[model samples]
Target: MTDISTTSRRNFMKLAATAGGGLVLAFSWTNTLASAVMEVLDDTNLASGKIDFNSYLSISPDDVITIFSPNPELGQNIKTSFPMIVAEELDADWTKVKVVQAPLDTNKFERQVTGGSGAVPHSWERLRKAGATARQMLLEAAAKRWKVSADTLTTENGVVVHKASGRKLTYGELATEASKVPVPTDVKLKDTKDFKLIGKAIRNVDNYEMITGKPLYGLDVYRDGMLYAVIQRPKAFGMKLKSVDAAAAKAIPGVVDVVTFKNNVAVVGTSTWQVNKARKALKIDYEAEAPLESSSDHDRIFKELLSSKEATVRRKDGDVEAAFKKAAKVVTAEYQCPFLSHSPMEPMNFFADVRPDGVELIGPIQTPERARADVAKLLNIAPEKVTLELTRLGGGFGRRLYGDYVLEAAELSSIVKKPIKLVWTREDDMTGGTYRPAVRYRFEAALDAKGNMIGYKLRGAGINSGNPTREDNFPSGAVENLLIDSIEHQSPITTGAWRAPITNFLAFAEQAFLDEVAQAAKKDPVQFRLELLDKAKNAPVGAIKYDIDRMKGVINLAAEKAGWGKKEGVSQGFSVYFSHRSYVAQVADVVMKEGKPAVDRIHAAVDCGIVVNLSGAYQQVRGGVIDGLGHAIYSNLTFKDGAAEQSNFNNYRLIRMKEVPEVDVYFVNNGIDPTGLGEPALPPTGGAVANAIYKATGKRLRNQPFINQPELKTV
Candidate 1:
């Protein structure tokens, strides 16, 4: 995974040079590296010298190695893991390495986005080269000073060694001289087996700061002369502002002003409490802009769309209708999932200082570039006139991808002619925020007389769930005849990407339906899936999008680890899925407890290629499983007249900590490029838990929020 490119090497090195005493090295994802670098030096030294390197790695005279993590960190541990990659290749002392969040610089960093679990996979190679390049430059510096060939020099824990002469120099001792060496494009990357910091378990760099209640998240951002604002939007999706009465709100002692923007009213004041109180005092009127649809309306629409002849054919192989007509048995089922709120711990908040010259924004946003561009567009300014800084996110879950709140802060600042910090109440986020679209899927399978599946067909309907079908996934290539199509109903309800997007609920529905088909065919659930995977591997029907070997690796590992079908009194349910370029298989162990099925443990097998941080990977898998299981069991979002039915945690049930089951995670480290861990583990969890429930009870749960099922009961 090493490459040598002389793209902009000399120019980049020239930009990296400093008048004072620190060595800096950087790498750009773009050709001709030209922007940000990680910097480490004394406060005085940093102030005295030019501090710029296209943002990646810098070594100080004190041997402090600072690695800049270019991606937004939202508890996915990119902050810790990204630095680990660079430090591993740089051969720096892990203890002396400091991780920093790099500001958004399109010129310096590429793909600064944090969504879709793509940050690590995209930055893997470039980060390794950045570190290796720095290490090479330091080695060459020591070689010149020693009058020996650079080939004889080796780096170990921030020190260069010439084992033949038994002479060594710390990276700190050669920091100044290293800066003068030509940036090496012919740098070598370490083999996975030689990694010292990557595979090892490492704690989050901000663990102490987070636990001690330090200021890290966007809500903690503050600036001089800042005004707090709380926006009041229409309660229903298809409603617009009619009239606003801000007389009572303006009479409040702390209320500075109340202004209307884009059909929403913003109450500005000096403190959060003041603005919140003033906002509550105001009386506003709203008018229906469109039909105020409800959950029942969506249900009817889903039915109509599923049966509609007008559908977009995403993929088709062979003749599905012909295969179905000749089949001996056909099994059909429908699965439904409700809309969900992102519900990140920290509510939406952003600080914006909009001036005539430029705008400064600070927040916990997943997409900084979009936010900057959006603000610039809104204010009629150039994109370069906006400076955006990223803070540690409390939790993203894909909600931060949209820059609506960022736009709100910038717009309010411009209106009030003061620095504005806009904060959304939990109610605002839950009822008015973009949500995970409610989707319905109808799956049909045709089996021949030999109990072998011949045809697979799927039709999906959703409220803004774009392309609800994963047309190229698992079962598609395994069947001789396959057809996947989807239709969506346009609605005023705003919907956006959740954790795993369409697969979050699709996996559950598909796997559960497959299990039912296996029962109809009188085959074991695990064995049935294995047979299909074997078909895809040996004689695929169409273009296979998934790696058969990787998928089977996880399935076999999970089954063996959970001792599938071996534990008496425990109903084990198995499920596997491929998403975000990774494969995950989970087996849930359910046992009867007080006349109710309780999942006691789950065994997970993952093939995400080379793991960056073992501890973080485990944590991510465990967290994703818990999130998926909890949401499947109890979480749901319903609507009445285009208004959310649930407001907060009291009504919307989250899995209790005590109710969480034990999770055993195992990874298949096959030495491939690392994929994403943030989302792949979550997609299959619902399926495993649902299948386990079905095994425990003779009833099938086709709907999400299993608590809604009348036959299901829990303590």
Candidate 2:
């Protein structure tokens, strides 16, 4: 009965007739709070005595403040960090603040999508304004009661105090009165110096539920009488289902029904085990609909594309041909990275109940709004007829953004005329498409007599992924006569964003290539980079997309903390990158053990602007760095005749605990508005590790999954 919708501007806060007598406020972030309207649920929906306040928050008679985090939580700690933003402005006691996940209401929330590390930046001002507005209303209520000017009152931990008269009122006591006050359009925001909860380390709000085996993920969703379904999809790319025989599958013990839709077969049964067991008995035939491509074919295509002149130019500076012709030394290398799967631990699962009235969806999805729309479209129903409830995602890394699994479950439920829950086995999830495309980058840099980089040329070729080059990044503005271009080939194999996207592999290749250029010039690697940065700062160059001072800040901090070039017996490599509107610098430490180079630790320095929660921010940086390093060292996806060569973890290796290096995270807090943290820290980690390997064993890692190379071995 509680529904949130947007309307024309009226008031920022509205008094709700709640049975429990509490305040309610609602607003939107679009147009900077100028076009948003506020509403509160009536007393009929407040039978539980808890008011469904604004779209962002609800206050109770017991002094408890519940803040709704509209964005999906994918272990980025947004569920905790976002609420902290509100609590800071509300001046609420941290102990009494509660965080809840807001359901999918496109009208109520802005930018509900969770990927790209953009949640904080998108909601920072809006969330702060929400809390401040509520606090202002409370202060006005207290001032009216005391018959004093509102300016005379100050708030301390959810209490409005009039120090002149020694009179104070708790938020709970003034809640009913506050609800009657007119909404303040403009409220003063707290200065950064007064933030108590914004900088402090706060643990995840759902830690208790997550650790104690409480149901929080998509795979844990269940409903009475809901059937379990396991689908049988095409085993390889470029193939489609020609036919399917469901008789044997239906005959399996505990099997209830067998349904085929969208060229795939789904086995529905009483339990997950029954459906999974029944799926193994399905007889299906698939035929190639497109050219069956293999890893070798991609490799050949990459080489051809790099040498071909048919590439789209993204950026060009000065005359590259003239600069390279006059250079004393030319450095060239080719870097290759394979396709990768976003193998979230929970896999893909969704619960869908389709009926004539409406559709109910409950699961862990990064893009709930997109899923709602896709399901509505698939079922030929109105978008608003579908309601989605988001669960704590085990992990996304861009896999859940497509919502293919959600569509499958909705389709199955509609076909069988029953509520259904769909789950994918680990093998099915791995072999599924929408992978990080395989890419190759060919880099050539021209160095003059003084070993100063004069010209840089980069050509990137990728399968499925468009424009593999970040042309406006670090070196682009620093170097003279820089040229960047790319070529892409269409493939039946699906690919999408994986973590940091194109920058994930490109950063490593560019950084490692820079190190090689530095070595050839006989200059210190760190100094060489600093010199280029100085040139970009002082000299003439094309449009510089990255902030030079911020980039330098992280680089200086990471180098100083890691004790670069000061520790003996430990070889160090340095890498810095600017991506997703953030700058990150990482220093990797490597040592020779038993004639093999082993990564010991990583020192990461980030400048993502003002951090909301230090603890969560630190963990995010560490996790991103570790994820990047692990994938670079041990992860790669290959195909043989259109089928995935590696099905499970046994063949598709990942960095184990023993191979994981210690990560020390540091942040440069400049009080700038927050940008993104989920991806910036990851892009530079691969380059740092690659350079560290080069330092330890004098071998260049031009290929992803350094595991495949004989030069370096960690296990």
lDDT of 1 at 445: 95
- Over 1-715, each residue of candidate 2 has an lDDT whose tens digit, in order, gives 1222222112212222234677766657564334234444334444443432336566667787876677889898888987788888999878888776777877767678899888888778878887888898899899899899999999989889999989888888888788778887677899998888898889889989888888778777777778999898888898999998888888888899988777788899998899998898888999999999999999889889988989999999999999999999999999999999899898899989999999999888889998998899898999999889888898889898889999999999999999898999989989985799899999999999999999999999999889899898988788889999999999989899999989999999999999999999999888889999999999858999889999999999999999999999999999999999999999999998888888999999999999998888988898899899999988989999899988889988888888888899988979988999988999999899889888888888999989898666533
C-alpha RMSD between model 2 and the true structure: 3.7
Off by over 4 Å in 1: 1-20, 31-53, 713-715
Clashing pairs for model 1 are 35-54, 36-53, 36-54, 36-55, 37-53, 37-54, 37-55, 37-56, 38-56
User: Which residue pairs show collisions in model 2?
Assistant: 25-54
lDDT of 1 by residue, 1-715 (tens): 1211112323333333334476866556553232223343333534454544446577777788876666889999889988888889989999988877777778767778899888788878877877888888899899999999999988899899999999999988898888778776467789888998888999999999889887778888877678999999999999999998899999998899999999899999989999999999989999999999999998899989999999999999999999999999999999999999999999999989899989888888999999999999999999998888888898989999999999999999999999998999999999998899999999999999989999999998889998998999998899999999999999999999999998999999999999999988899998999999999888888799998889989999999999999999999888999999999999999999888899999999999999999999999999999999999988999899989999998897889999999999999979999998999999899889889988999778899899898758532
Reference-based TM-score of each model = 0.95, 0.95
After superposing candidate 2 on the true structure, give the runs of residues whose Cα lies further than 4 Å from its correct spot.
1-18, 31-54, 713-715
RMSD each, Å: 5.1, 3.7
Give the range where candidate 1 is weakest over 10 consecutive residues by summed lDDT.
1-10
Give the whole-model CA lDDT for all candidates, comma-separated. Answer: 0.87, 0.85
Cα misplacement distance, residue 674 of candidate 2 (Å) = 1.0
